[model samples]
Target: MRPSIKILEEDMKEKVVLEAMEILEEIGFFVENTEAVEILRNAGINVDSETQRALIPADLVKKSLKTAPQSISLYNRDGDFVTVLGGDNICFDPGSAALNVLDQETNEIRTAVTKDFVDFTKVVDQLEHIQAQSTAITCSDVPEKISDRYRLLIALIFSKKPIVTGTFVKESFEVMKDMLVAVRGSEEELRRKPLAIFDACPSPPLKWSDLTCQSIIDCAKYGIPSEFVSMPMTGATAPVTILGSIVQHAAETLAGLVITQIVSPGAPVIWGGSPAAFDMRKGTMYLASVDTILMDLGYVEIGKYLNLPTHAYLGMSDAKILDTQAGFETGMGSLLAGIKGVNMISGAGMMNFESTQSIQKVVIDNEIAGMTYKFVKGITQRDEPIAKNLLKEFDKKTHLLSHDHTMKWFREELYLPSTVVDRSTNEEWITKGRKSIGERANETVTKLLSKYPGVSLDNDIIEDLTRIMKYENVDFKTKLDL
Candidate 1:
């Protein structure tokens, strides 16, 4: 049997859902978009005109849950199937929208440029365990207005993986959607096989902004998947207790679900979030704290209870730099998320309370992800008589090392990591240059980028993508070398 972890029992899950629905029905959620408000009103839900708060009943919540898809299929830019966002199938991608990058040479956090993002995409493209690419870092060279779409453009040019991206404003979605259409050759095909999932976040204490509401509606209309990222800071923006914060998260996510399902009956949606446990003494939000990880796992159980695809911001650190603290937090959270079978695990390379991205950390986290995947597979009986038959052949003259059984199962059972992880003896380490983990990861990054086979896009498609961007008043030719 596959190993797993659970925080809420069957009855506890039911209680969480029931309380969430009650909160939505009584307290209501603030909906800023007029279009969204009208959609809810048309669906027979009560809405206040001045306040824009919609009172969604339990029946509406149940209906929306029924209409929303249980699974979402993501496709690469080349129209190949990548993975499904449901069940116990988990996939990992580097975190998104970091303002700064950890410089390899100086080991200092600085604003990321186009070259930095390019190198990051190339390295992630080569990593074996990181399943998808994200609009990981914003380029300081580009204008703030075009930052969202520009990052997506860079990711598409360098990697073929499906993207996990989001819009910064309402207008950026159409331009980004145009880029996806250009890659897929047509809007119909783009809708048929979605190449990306957009993240739409809800403000804590049960609120939805106009931009995010519009994003959910637009993605639903185009048949693209939308992930609800409800961030609830315990004892700060949300209630002090973990379960209380989860209830708030559920209410906010359920509100978004109602909007999406109302816009399109069978629209695809993911129950995802980036909630953190608040540190009152430091007045900081801890992404890797034990309380925060427990909250993530608990909410995922609620998502599974409702039979929806789930996601969370785990496998990240609160440390400012890459150190023992970074490794300890990242490994613990990542392993638990893997065991719990979160469908889309983000925040692989993020640090400093999710404000920074580290290339070295990403390389090391790739190894951690590999081990987590192996651990979840668990151990199985390899032979009919268990180990008795193999023990019979394990004599003094012929050791198990030379036996056929050892040769057959050793490679399959063991998860041999890359050079990013140290597995050498004392003498071997001294002879081969005792490099730090960061040093080895830096070398791996350089090697991967040096050997990366660049993506080849058709000239026509490239021109189309460029034209779409140029129409938005940003000239890529002047700023970047295409």
Candidate 2:
């Protein structure tokens, strides 16, 4: 049996869902998009145009819960399976919209730029453990209005992996859709093989921003998958109790589901979030805190109860760098989320409270992801009663290396990590340079980049994407010419 972890019992999960439904009916939520409010009004929902308060009824929530697809498929640009999101399917990707990167050359945090996004995508493409890629960092070099779209463009041009991206600016939404079409050939084909999933977040305290609301409706209309990111800060924007936080998360995501399904029935969406507890002592939100992991697992359990695909922010560090603190936090968060079977666990390369990205840290986390996945896979009984025969034939002079059984099962039974992790004796360490994990990871990154061709697109698609970038007045060639 595969190793797994869960905290909420079935009856407890039902209670959480009931509480969420009650919150949606009694308290309601704010809908900032005027069109969204009108859609709800047309659906017989009680709406106050002045306050934007949409009191979604229990029937509407239940209908949405029924209509939303239970599973979502994300394909790479080449139209291949990156992951099927639902049930026990688990996948990992780096986080999005980080502003800084830990510069390997200088060993200092620097503002991330377009090149940083490109290089990050290259690393993600090479990591077998990372199933999908996100617009890992926003390039400060690009125009603020087009940064989100620019990241998507870079992802398409550099990596063939499925992408997790979003648009913060409303006007750029159509442009982003057009950019996707440029890579995907046409609108219908793009929808049929959606190479990316957009993340639409709802504001805390029961509010959905106009952009995010429109994103939900647009993604539904376009037939692209969307993830509802309901970020609730406990003891600040939400209730302090963990159960209360999950209830709030459920309510918020349910509101999104209602909006999305209302726009287009049976639209695909994932139950996703990046919530955390507010630490009064530090005067900050502990997104990578251990408590946050519990909260994420609880929300995922609720999603599974509804038979929906789930996602969460895990495998990140609240620590400033790739030190001991980063190691333990990332290891624990990744292992727990993987074993819990979160469909799409984000925040792999994240550091310093998820504000920065690092190539070295990503390399390290890639190894962590491999080990966690191995642990989740558990041990399989490849053969029965074979150990008795092997033991009977074994002697003090015999070696397992000489046996055929050892060679056949060793590769499958063990997780042989790459050079990113060190497993050497003191003498072996001295023979080498006694390099740190960071140093070894840096060397690996260098080797990977050296082998990467830097660009992976047909001439026609490249020209079209560049034309779109130029239309936005973005200097795409300047950064990608390498």
On lDDT, the leading prediction is 1
Q: Please report the TM-score between candidate 1 and the true structure.
A: 0.98
| Model 1: CA > 4 A from native | 396-398, 471-474, 477-480
Give TM per candidate: 0.98, 0.98
lDDT of 2 at 323: 87
lDDT of 2 by residue, 97-118 (tens): 8999999878788899877888
Residue ranges of candidate 2 with Cα displaced over 4 Å: 471-473
lDDT of each: 0.91, 0.88
Compose the digit string of candidate 1's lDDT tens values, residues 153-209. Answer: 888888989999999989999999999999998889988898999999998889999
lDDT accuracy of residue 481 in candidate 2: 80
Whole-model lDDT, model 2: 0.88
